[model samples]
Target: MHLVIVTAFDYPDGGPVAARHLALTAGLAQEGHRVSFVMLHQARPPAGARSNPAITWTSIARAGSTSPLAWRLTALRRLDRSIGSAAATGAVDAVLAAVRDPLLLEATLRAARRRGIPVLHELLEYPDVVRPPGPLGRVQEQVFVRRHLPAFDGVLVISGALEEYAARSGVARTALLGSIVDTALETPLDPLKLTTTFTVGYAGSLVQEKDGVLTLLRAAAAAAARLAPRYELRLEILGDTRPAAGLTATRESHRLGLDGRATFHGLVPHDQVRGILARCHLLALPRPVSRQASGGFPTKLGEYLATARPVLTTAVGEIPRHLRDGETCLMVAPNDEGALARALVGAASSYDAAREVGRRGRGLIDASFSAPVQARKVVGLVESLRGARP
Candidate 1:
């Protein structure tokens, strides 16, 4: 199948969204599917950014637009043209869109409809989770999710929660395409090797409300004091330290007396993240229980597991369904600093046991969360849609 993936994900080296799409597309290409990745937003690729030769990349920049209205109009026209051209080639099979904007989503549906091409909406999270919408935006989101979403040929969801949500919203066809990682790229580290300092690493957003970074900081401070007698504890955080809007990790780290022990490496190249994670003795994703946390699965968790490093995370969302508490990873209750701190100390104390858990977690990734595994589900969805179409 020749699939067109339309998204706002930054090209080359962006964030988790980009990483997810890249891995999925690579898997699709490996399955002999041709992919055209269309970027709706303009982003400057950072140094050391790399591209895949199997996929074709296209950018539709909102060039010289002064206002939101103007940019939306320009984007719609350009996207329509782009889809039309691809449809004219007769090689394009379907369009899978990861766009969230209601207006743009409607435009994409219309464009695809005009070309007799089916459009599938990719649902990553609950509408209210990510940058929460305003009153007006909420109204738009409701209309889109309830009325517009069901109108798509199918919906591709990233989590079981999202798949159920889509099905309840009257979407006839829904596919679960959960958190995926390129297992081939993630080399597991030896669990028995001892480092001078026991490092707890976290990659992704540092926002308190998002990933519960403040809770993590407080827990780390407590863990540091307890681990000091046995081994020095270091905290390594990688991601955008300067969020557009939210609580910053650095200020909280200092307030919690972890200034000297914590190191923040602001957004680096995507390929380098796994290597850095492998060096750490432990990885964490202490997301608090919230609508956002339960609705979407963290892509970083798959990467962390792929590294075969013992992960300490909360029991929220679909995580418990895929991983066992003591078998695959160390699970703790969300929003509890004390529990998390204790879990961290326990995992460090029983390093050999934790390493075995990490090894099992990597095996789980290969069996369930790997890109190739999820991509096959995607291929099945597309073929079913094609067969049903008159």
Candidate 2:
């Protein structure tokens, strides 16, 4: 099958967003499908990294425009042309679009419908769930989920939470293809390669409203205070640590008296993330439950589990279904700093058992959520959609 995947972000950019898309593209190509990755935003390919010939990468939007409205108009116009061109050339059987912008989604759907191509809208996050939550988010939900989503031929959701959301919105054809990771790219480092410090690493945005990093900080501080003189809990946070909701992760670290214990390495390349994770004893994703979390799964969880490192995270979203507490991960209730601190101490006290638990998580990924496995599932979904046609 020939497929065109449209996304609203720059490609070859190191992040879970790009990683998941890249994995899916590679997987589809490996499954003998001709796949083209269409980026809604223009980006330069990473230096020294060659393009994946199996997956054609292209962009419909031009960069360096000063006016937001002008760029949007231009991109919408280009989107129509691109979809028409792909259809006219008879090079694509279906179109799969993943974009946060409701306007972009509407444009893509309109263009694809005009071209008679089966379009699949991939929902990664719910519009109602946004940081600094307000009316704009509700407006997006109205436009995208309530009004436009059901019109698509099919919907691909990243989590069961989004699948339920789609079902409630009258979308009958929905696929729950949760976050994916290339297990081959992420393997546990040798125990001898461990970092000198007892590091607990968290990757991704430090935005308190989104990831609950502040809670993790408080828990870490509490755990450190309790475990003082026995073990010093060192935190290495990779990714953007900038302020959101009036304070940054670093500021909170100081407020909690975790001066030297907490080290923030603001955004690094995606390729470098695994290497950093390899240095940590455990990975932490302390996201609190919210409308946002309920509708999506974190891509980092897959990557973290792939590293075969003990992960401490809250039972939010579809996480409880995938990761069993005390089995594949050390789980705690969302927003409970005391529970988080206790989980941290438990992970520290039972280091060997935690390593075994991490190993089990890696095994689970191999059996269910590896890149190849997810790619095959996506291929199956695409096949089903194609077969449904007359």
Candidate 3:
């Protein structure tokens, strides 16, 4: 089968969402499907794209102006044309779009209908959860929940929580196409050897509100002060550090006297992330309670599990449901600094046991969340949609 995946960002971009798509695409291709990616707004072949060799990328033209409105208009026009052309020329057999913009999604549906092909929407984030707090957000939510979703043949959600959201939003057919980790690429590392400084790793944005970067920093500082003699703790946050939150977080770290204890490796390629994770004694995913947190699962969580490292994350969304609190991964309440510090201290106190828990987390990934596993489910959904098309 030839498949086209539509996204709101560039193909194989440096982020967790792109990582999820690339992993799924690789799995689909490995399952003998030719896949292509169509990016709506941004289109610059990521410097180090890890997409499968069989996966092709199509870039749509964009407006010269940098304004958000202009970018969207140009993106919609180009997306409709590009998808329609591909469908008409037999370059694609089915459409799998992961777009949040209503207009871009409409364009994709129109293109699929033009060729009488099946189209499915992949819901990574519930729009209502991430939308800005304003009337415009309500309007967009109505458009997505009432207008766009039911029009599609089916929906592929990132979590069971998201599947419920889709069902309530009037989507007739929904599948839980959860996040996939490329365990083959990111095999579990051996138990980390004791070093002078215990490294706690985090990968992704420093978005203070959503990812709990601030919380992690404060917790680490508190933990370091308390456990000064036992083990020196350091944080290695890897991702794009250009956001304003990064600067603010850095200032806070210094204000908390964690100047040298916290290191930021800004925006490395996806492939190198695993090597960095391998150096860490523990992985931290201190996600706070937010709209995105409630409806979507983080791709980094899957990767963290794949690394076979003891993970410390908040009990938000499907996290606590999917992973055992004391068995697989350490669970802390969202934004609870004291709980996070205690979990951190506990992990350090029983380092050997935490390694056992890390292996257990990896076991869960192998059983249910590996790339091949989730990709087969996604391909099954796509095949069903294709078969249902008249």
Candidate 4:
């Protein structure tokens, strides 16, 4: 199939957002599709971003935040020419506007409509779920629920709950694809490769929405105070650090006298995280209530399990369905300092028992989370659209 993927989220800086698309393009290309990734951001799309030779990329720099009047108009004009060029000969099979931002979703839908292309909007998170901000933000959110949704040929949701939620909003053709990860690269590391430390780790943006970062901080403090004097809990955080979010993540570390004990490895490239997972004993994050938590599959969760590390999470949303507490990991309530503390203490007291949990997690990843499995499922979706005629 010949395809064009439109995304509002900028790839290079959006971290996981960009990486996922790169993975998808590669996966689709390997499956024999001609793919083009079009970013809403204007910067030169990163060179060699996709491994699949059949995949290409395009970008439109939103001159003023991608939402402002001038920027939106300019983008639409550029998009008009681009889509017209792609479909001029009627050769394109479909268009996928992976809707991460609501405002741009409307534009893409309108453009895809003008071009007479089948469009699929991947709903990993919703406008109500993200709750962006201000009058314009609310307008965009409502637009997604009221207008943008109905414009697409089909809707792709990452969770069963999300599919039902979309259905309630009168969305038809909604399908739950769950979330995806390249699982082959995610297999557990050799036990001998890991250098054990009394450590608890969390990776990804230090943003407050996730909730897991804070939970990990409190748990560390509790573990430090409650554990044997010889067991010093070390902290390892990976991902981007924004000032607003960093203030909180760091404040707790200082108050707990964990300055020297904690290490913040900021935004290391995607592959570097896998290597860090090898030395990690436990992956901690309890994002119980975030929109992403409830509506999407976290890529890191699969990676952690692949590393065969025991996870201490709230197990809410897709996390619970994917990770079984006691069997594969330990679950605590979200944002509960006391519960998180207790879980930490328990794990510290019985490191060997915790190791068993890690083993189970790795087994789960091996059994169900392989990259081929994820790629094939996605390919199946695209294939289903192949024979439909206008």
- Listed per model in order, the count of residue pairs whose N, CA or C atoms clash below 3 Å is 0, 0, 1, 4
The residue-by-residue lDDT of candidate 1 on 218-295, one tens digit each, is: 999999899887778888888787674223678878888887789888887876776677678999999998888888
On a 0 to 100 scale, what is the lDDT of residue 351 in model 4? 74
Q: Which regions of candidate 1 fall more than 4 Å away from where they truly are?
A: 43-53, 62-71, 189-192, 243-248
Candidate 2 runs further than 4 Å off? 43-50, 87-90, 130-137, 192-196
Candidate 3 stretches greater than 4 Å from native? 42-44, 47-53, 62-74, 88-93, 132-135, 239-242
Error of 3 at 318 (Å): 0.3
Between which residue pairs do clashes occur in model 1?
A: none
- 23: Cα error in model 2, Å: 2.1
The sequence of per-residue lDDT tens digits that candidate 2 reaches over residues 108-172 is: 88887776788887777875564125777677777776678888778878888778878888887
- Tell me the lDDT of model 2 at 231: 75
How do the residues 83-147 of candidate 3 rate in per-residue lDDT, one tens digit apiece? 87666545576788777777787888887788777788878887776566799888988887788
Of the pair 1 and 2, which is ahead by TM-score? 1
lDDT score, candidate 4, position 261: 80
Using TM-score as the yardstick, the better of models 3 and 4 is 3
Q: Tens-digit lDDT track for model 4 on 1-390?
A: 777887666654466556566555655665666777665565566645655567666666554464556655566667766666667644676688865456566677778777667788777775576656888778877877787776667666767777877787776565565434555445566663223357777888687677567767766877777774757778888866657787777776788778888888877776577777666677887775866677777766766676777788786787787777788888887778789888887876777788889889877765665544555565565556655534
Candidate 1 minimal-lDDT segment of 10 residues: 42-51
Instruction: Please provide TM-scores, in order, for all candidate models, with all chains considered together.
Output: 0.92, 0.91, 0.90, 0.85
